[model samples]
Target: MSQTSTAFRGVERLVAGQQTADGAGVRLTRVLTQNLQRRLDPFLMLDAFRNENPDDYIGGFPDHPHRGFETITYMLAGRMRHHDSAGNQGLLGPGGMQWMVAGSGLIHSELPEQESGLMEGFQLWLNLPAADKMMAPNYRDVPSAAIPEYTSASGVHVRVIAGESHGTVGAVQRPVTEPLYLDIHLLAGSRFEQAIPAGHNAFAYVYRGRAEIAGTAVDDRQMAILANDGAAGVVIEAPVDSRLILVAGHPLDEPIAQYGPFVMNTAEQIEQTLRDYRDGKFEAAVVQAL
Candidate 1:
């Protein structure tokens, strides 16, 4: 075979699964997320949780302020009602996603309805480039059915969420970090492979079941970071009954200084972010600062 596959050097396996609280102490899993510090380049965090009892996730994310970033919430099951100061509101069901760009600033709240049942989902954070960090606030609420998926002949399933990879492309169009977000599942006794562009950093997060990634055995609740291949495309392997989240993006290769919901390149920027929020220097529309 010709040299066409991107081979990542070194896989930094993050620590085992951890948990954190949101929206009044509602608990959630910090799985394959929070690589924002070092490993995952431009992406900030990923939180996954499953709630059956009301107490598990009842008190949803209350009115919170955000700036210089975007939040993408994907629901696996149950309903999530959303209301934002940007005048955007909707209900996110299983397979639904709420993609909000908190440029400049915005306040939003997400609360689950009265229905009682299993509610599972993921919330991801992506940073805006320095030039676009202070842009206008916007949102993209993608319903479950609106998002497209492509299944391979080998039973490898790929859902395009924000970017494009393999032969599948997500619907949302923006100046992304040239990334590909895919949710994949491999059937029993199956082997799957997908190609990734060269020079992009790639990682695999095993969400459910066990699978072999990059020739390394990664079971549930673990993440494998692959080294950049520069110009050669990369491929991933998935064993039977394995579910994986494959994400690859061009590294910003820039300095990152983060504080709560604001991420900038310098300490002065972080301080200015707080000042703007407190003094109404950045508030647009009737946005709340909670």
Candidate 2:
């Protein structure tokens, strides 16, 4: 187990979310900043999506390009297969994850593997610093069976996706951002506590049931940004069986220029990315896994 910091941030504010459609009409709730306020900084955006109606999700996300950031997809139900510009392809099932570094640029598509009985997942965007923005693109895909899990005496199951939890390190091959991403499930009336990086900005998204974070009742699909006040970690109370995703990352603290699928340091850089995509750089890059 990672040592808990002496002081940790508590729930500061609740961020309301809205639904938005992107990538060939994949409808999802958009969380985090909608404008360029950059309130979330290194953690750009989080999308919480769940649909049982086949028509609601069967379309999936089609080919899309990304740059100057990383995209992480965690599946809780159903299956998705991805194909990228570099000829890399893989399938993600329940409890699986895919972390893609669209460093310079990359093109990819996530499509449902079947007609779809139920589909639920999240796609998180974590920004890269200006220094690492234009690096080479890479992909890391981890299956459900491969992720590290820990069960507590209270029946809280924690999936360490990209951080240390319960004495187990996450499976995510995260390097640049070195962020912590954890999926936590708490049984009814269970409690959860985990250490977080002292220097990183952190937030938690309650997806199911209710989480009493810092004594505030956070409902489903709600997010709480942890206060920056020095504190070791967060303590959560699950009145009912609840699920949440915790994310924390180092802030790039750089000027952000975002245009559709591109996030760069400046408008000129965004234009450059467009030019590169128009010039077919992502597709032409040599195929390899990171």
Candidate 3:
């Protein structure tokens, strides 16, 4: 039997992501923008991209600099090649994930490895705490086979990417943020429930098909921000074959200052980051590959 929660969190509100383009004109939806950073603490941004036309994603993301945050790229289709100034390189294909920490700073590029095909994925920016903002950069490439997955008793297929689900541990875990990232697939009339710490902020993003989250209808491409109403967990039901990502994380409750790709706790830090990049400091920083 699937685990159950006596009290389930409800949807606080629905967000229709803004359509935007970035990284050499690649089109995507900015789901978690700057305005929601504080509301969804520790999670800076979430960009969803899906395209079939080569023209839409041909240019790809050229060299860019980032600092004071970590980026997680989860690919559902196609292939992307990652290269960084610290001599780190990896290829992320369907069902693979790439996690990179731009602790101090780094220059990197993500380019398409295929000429024509469907390119779909999500890039989530997770903020680093002030104390660890200047730590050494780190990178990890988790292939599809590396991610832990299981099927619940109710036929809900789950992929544990960054936290525990049911009894299965995810591929990665962070002590500070304690993020829970689950890719859930539910067949028609299926129900799934997962316990969440009452203190953590949570939300769900429906990527395919539709589902009802805590009695609120969540359609495809919509994000439902779960209320922090002292609920013990969340409950989801699907009327059709639907897939979604459930994400919850402990809030840092710290000030956030961001300038383009750089995020810091203060404006002075942001200024220092600019000078560091201009002095070519990022190129000299060593990257520890995990």
Candidate 4:
């Protein structure tokens, strides 16, 4: 467990609007600032995109390129048709997760099915270590049934996405440092506690209800970053119907070079990623971008 209490910046709220690039979906919310990055390392951005209108979603994400990082998509409401350059294909529905590691390179696209009602999900990016950054690409598609859920002694129901905590191990074995991704739902007047690694950075993203983190009040629709200064495990005294995401991961001390949809080690690498895309060298996945 950590030694200090969690002191996090409250969730940064965003209103997602329609700004179609390669995908037909809209970005409902996003975490994209230095303030947000300080607490969430290894992980870069969090974007929640959804489209209820079939016409709107049919456009989908055309073939695109990615390298140097991983993309995790957790479907909350509808179905998405995914295809990649590696000949990967699937239809992911609610509770399904697609963890794609774009090491040296990979190209893929996701398009919502016409019959699916509301298409909602989150896409998270995780950086790879220098040694593994250029390794072969990989993919893991976890169906909803495969994801394990459990109720803690304290009555906090959790869905494990990756890593482990609260006595439940996320089925997907994460390749990076010890990480914890838990979807925590707490009852009223309940206290939630879990042992986190001593030096990992932790945070809670509240999707509903209200809660208090180390005496700090966090209401619904807010995200709280746990203090990084070697703090003890987190304690949440939450109100009823409180839904939050608890995540903790070891910090990567390497420098970050990010551009658009790719993250790498150096500025030159960022330039190379863009150059590769423009040069058509990374278009092996899905239908290549027009």
Candidate 5:
């Protein structure tokens, strides 16, 4: 097969997240939220939690309700014990990821497995279109061993979680918005590029080291939201060894209304979700999956 060069998607802006506490005092960095920036369409929020102190992260996230979107939890270090209204329970450890489809609604809890050593992870919220908002809830949890990894000749490594790269496809399938999620690492002087869908929104969040994104320098814990006015790819060159997460997805282009953990396309839907949740829709929602 002929190789296509990844094009230049201009950098739209550079931004950084802030420290915030959510869900029973679990501290995290809130990078993207509905109120923080303009509509990112298919995506809603991205939270990065990295803590070594027991007091900082021991609280964990207690039972919470969600609807109208999907929640993706990826662990880079430590362990998170998960239990939900749907009878799903498991231990999400280092390198594992859980994708929760909160179409309609579900209640779940995530707690630290131990007092603490270090807990590092990311939780991404992807919006669902009006059509799929009321669909049945589900989940897809992939272990580290099941995820696909690729290493280049120049020492650029990638973990493909929900897209295709280097002829290898990720384990996630049937996404409504057709998203691309990758954890990338680059050695100093190494360059990496990847194709993106035309007209789709794309962004890169650098959490470690520094890199030049589309000719713009981005430091750790910062983000570069690409403009759709340019080419259809993201290009990166690491002046120093770096690690980052790259995400892009087709926009739903629909109205969005969010309240706490509940997200919907309309305030009426949000109200309905609240009513259903309060009325016990997810009260007995445990469905075992092995």
Candidate 6:
């Protein structure tokens, strides 16, 4: 039998992300900033971008370097082309996703494939354990149809992106973090529940419409941090049609040192990463990984 959640988690706090521009002046909202890294262990940052104007995202992301972490990009609309130093290339379309692990290091670019129209998506940074920080780099492109999804009897639709949901496994899984990423759509007056492991840290980000968690209203574009108050799981209800992404992961509880795309366990490691990039070592690392 599927374990059910009797005690539901409540909203500890709500976050209204800061407006920020990145990647050649592409505007976006930085949802999970650096301050929350320790609190939301194993997760570094979350950036949400939804732009209709060409000027807002025309430049897209130019050549960039990253190391010691993973980036998960989910596209809701529009197209983006990805090219990396490791000779990995892919086109991410609507409802598609790109999961890139910048283990040792990698230089990559994500530029828009279209001139106009809505371009909505999210980029989540998941931390890597110290043991796997220097492992081989990896990348995977997952199309919309490839993701596992299901609809509950209560009219709640769920797309499992990175972990198991109600026995439906996601497209990708990491043993160390055991991250859970779910995109859920709820009809008016519908309710949904999922049993979350007690030890994992969890939160819900509402992207469309409004929803309720433990009687607290979570409006659109808001993120609700779930309290670890001995709740078995999370219970979400929609008074009206709504969409949200639920993310949970095991806490690494390790030291986090980050310096613009480089995340390491120690400041010395970060300094070494900077020096490596200056010496054009990222390309070599990518070639070695390949």
* Best candidate, lDDT: 3
lDDT of 5: 0.84
Query: What 10-residue stretch in candidate 2 is worst by lDDT?
Result: 1-10
Per-residue lDDT for 80-177 in model 6, tens only? 99999977789999989998899989899999999999999999999999999998888889999999999998879999999988999999999889
lDDT of 5 by residue, 157-274 (tens): 9999887777778768546688889999999999988888778788888989998987899999997888887477778999999999998888888888888888887888888877
- Write the residue-wise lDDT of candidate 3 on 1-290 in tens digits: 24578899999999989998999889999999899999999899999999999888888999999999999999999999999998889999999999899999989999999999999999999999999999999999999999999998789999999989888999999878989999999999999999888888899999999999989999999999999888879999999999999999999999999999999999999999999999999888788985
TM-score of 6: 0.97
User: Taking the tens digit of each residue's C-alpha lDDT, what string does model 1 give over 1-290?
Assistant: 23235453445565455887878667888764554445677778778787788888888888888888778888888888998765668899898887888888877889987558888878877777788887778887788888889887777787888576565668564575766777888887666555665666777777788777556778777777766645344455655588877777766777888888787778998898898888865445443221
Q: Which stretches of candidate 4 lie over 4 Å from their true place?
A: 1-22, 32-35, 50-58, 285-290
Residue-by-residue lDDT tens digits, candidate 2, 222-254? 999887666768888899889999887766688
TM-score of each: 0.89, 0.94, 0.98, 0.84, 0.95, 0.97
User: Count of backbone clashes for each model?
Assistant: 3, 7, 0, 12, 6, 0
Find the 10 residues in a row with the least total lDDT in model 3.
1-10
Clashing pairs in 1: 5-233, 6-233, 6-234
Itemize residue pairs with steric clashes in candidate 6.
Answer: none
Give me the runs in candidate 5 sitting further than 4 Å from their true place. 1-3, 36-38, 286-290
Give stretches of model 3 more than 4 Å off.
1-3
Q: Over 4 Å off in model 2, which ranges? A: 1-8
Tell me how far the alpha carbon of residue 248 in candidate 6 is from the true structure, in angstroms, after superposition.
0.2
lDDT of 2 at 52: 84
Superposed by TM-score, candidate 4 places the C-alpha of residue 181 at a distance from the truth, in angstroms, of 0.7
Judged by whole-model lDDT over C-alpha atoms, candidate 6 comes out at: 0.92
Across 15-105, the per-residue lDDT of candidate 4 in tens digits comes to 1223333354444556424345545677776665556666655677877778888888888888888888877788888989988888878
